[model samples]
Target: MLRLHRSALYYVRPLLRAALELTPSKSDTPVTFVPTVAGLLVRAQNENVAIEFTVEGAGSGAPISVPYGSLAKVEGRQHEPLELAATLEGNVFRWSEVGIPQVLSAPALEPAAWPSLPAQDCANDAELLTALREAAATTDIASLRYSLGCIRFRGDGGQLAATDGRQAILLSGFRFPWSGDVLARRCPVFTKLRLAATDERHVGRTEDWLVFRAPRWTLWLKIKHEARFPDVESQIPAREQADTTLSLAEADATFILQKLKHLPGGADQNEPITIDLNGSVAVRAKNDSSSVTELVLSSSERSGAQVRCCSDRRYLQRAVQLGFREILFRGTAAPLFCRDTRRAYVWALLSAEHCLKHNEQATRIASPRAATAVQWANSESNSGS
Candidate 1:
């Protein structure tokens, strides 16, 4: 059995909610809650990470038992009746679920093989979570095209990135706070995984898993390597090659996104929007009824610099959502680069057709940047040492 303070359960409870939904591929799996002397031991597949918490209280010495599959549905406290709840009341714990299997006793206990403590490679938790959340905001959920479903973390370059084949976000210097049975995680992990920023944190990697540890808790994530992450740096057109460097018009961009996001057409019927960069910016697209709608951006950096590209209208809105203060426009066919002034976070999106064609050609070239985003995150790993 395991014992934990009431507040502690409130904190880690959300994590149990984030475990991946079971699939035929089993790439996503739920956490296995095993009682341990340390506290509670939770494990995913070998490729995934587990979390352990230390419990202290008068009842800390007593054994605690949780059902094997109960981790996914834990809601530890509530004033009203709950179909299932593991509530904590003034150091006392009570649980009842309408339909779950009765867990009468703590399962067989065994020593768990834990990762080394005080991880060697580390980044501040708050900083890392900020970067990771930004990148994750743009990941694709409906399709499994390429590595679109996973966030790639580069430990060596200090980069984190995500793409849906149409648009991509790349951020540097983040420490990537990690998690879960993720009925959620695809986008929630970005904003969720609420570890305090004040705590000193470090993250390390074993053969195929990433370990993130804070003073109070630890999180591990599996390295997804079944598919290759495209070489993002090289795919982005070199700045020197851009014909027009423009500042993103936040107000105008937002107006355009709100209009097109609800356009009547289904995904299959969506049409590419064209951004005509001249003396100013003119964004043109169709509304739900296929009627042409145009918006102009007047504060462009350079006037009359002609360049044009047709891309997914929703992606343009997403670029604005990324909230880049400055943007760069290359040739009509190149992907658009929207980034912060500090160059800390970047988002790149090419038209669906162009994005696919670019990947085909990009595959023919070699990247000196790195093999994968996060299989190895340090310079030493690049040397194969």
Candidate 2:
């Protein structure tokens, strides 16, 4: 019997639970145990690495190896033949084992020719690289779709927009010079690009990978999720409404949002917050509990610009916290717009209901100075609602 440490036991429980949930109980699949499995071999491939494992018992036919990279964080003895206990979880095989040591083995990469990914020339590689990383972080993992002929590269580099219907993000500051109609192809390599320029310029290419480098660090990503992104070209509001240039101070936006964040159950979902631009800039928040709080945007130029729409306060807060010099809220229908003039690089759509809720809350919190700070604090305390 192998003695398990408290820490090790603690770590194994969740993994065992997950494996038990993922293993197939009804299927007859022979399990093949591979000894000397290299732990880090999966991490070192210049391109996406695929490994096949054969199961020894049960006869689900020959063992099929799926993408082992999708394993939820593997940990155990790396130098021992760690026995993987497989059980049935729904239609898949969940693996869990105890006290098995295995050495890491490098996967055999075949000498196969891979197509070249288009290379774009960027003046400042650092900025473009950073934007790619930030955009990648916002991607959804479960519903990711891949396309080989969907990669688009054009002269003058362009923006990359990705969304999964519920939420979307637009990243800009990409300037790459490539000739032709912006060829679109599937990226065949595992590419990593580090950003090192202040203006966001960087580029890199591996055997089958091309990296977009940035100023501070590099991003290693697999080129997946390349489907026809929705037609957002017509989503942007045309310049029609009387464009009001509102000067927003960073400190002021931060302070007001902080106050509005306190409303109970108000900011949850797409609850609209009201913005009263009459004499001074004001923001209001409310919840189902009938709790309301209002915050005033401390601005010097109060020309009275009023607009209301539904939005997720959390999204608005994140955009403001990113330090945009001026924020623009335009239009009232389907494809509402919110642009950060400071970065002038990213924009997002507003949620209609959230905008309306905030607007009403703002109206309620507007006049009373004595209750403003108190309400703000209480609202924050009960914000999870």
Output the number of the TM-score-best candidate: 1
Instruction: Report the Cα lDDT for residue 245, model 2.
Output: 37
CA-lDDT, candidates in order: 0.50, 0.40
Instruction: Show model 2 residue runs off by greater than 4 Å.
Output: 1-123, 137-154, 163-170, 179-201, 204-210, 213-226, 237-242, 300-305, 334-385
Task: Encode model 2's per-residue lDDT on 1-385: one tens digit a residue.
Answer: 0111223222332322322222345122221222222211111112332212111122222222222222232344332222222223211323244644332222222233323433553455344544544444334445545332233333343555544344445555555444322322322221232222344544434333444433322323333323444444355444344243345664465455565576555555665565545566666666776655666665423332456555556655655665544545454434333454212322354554455334332334332244364565466568843
Candidate 1 residue runs with Cα over 4 Å from true position: 1-11, 22-47, 53-65, 68-76, 79-119, 138-148, 174-188, 224-227, 253-271, 287-290, 298-304, 340-385
The C-alpha RMSD of each candidate to the native structure, in angstroms, is 13.8, 10.6
Cα lDDT of candidate 1 equals: 0.50
For model 2 the TM-score comes to 0.51
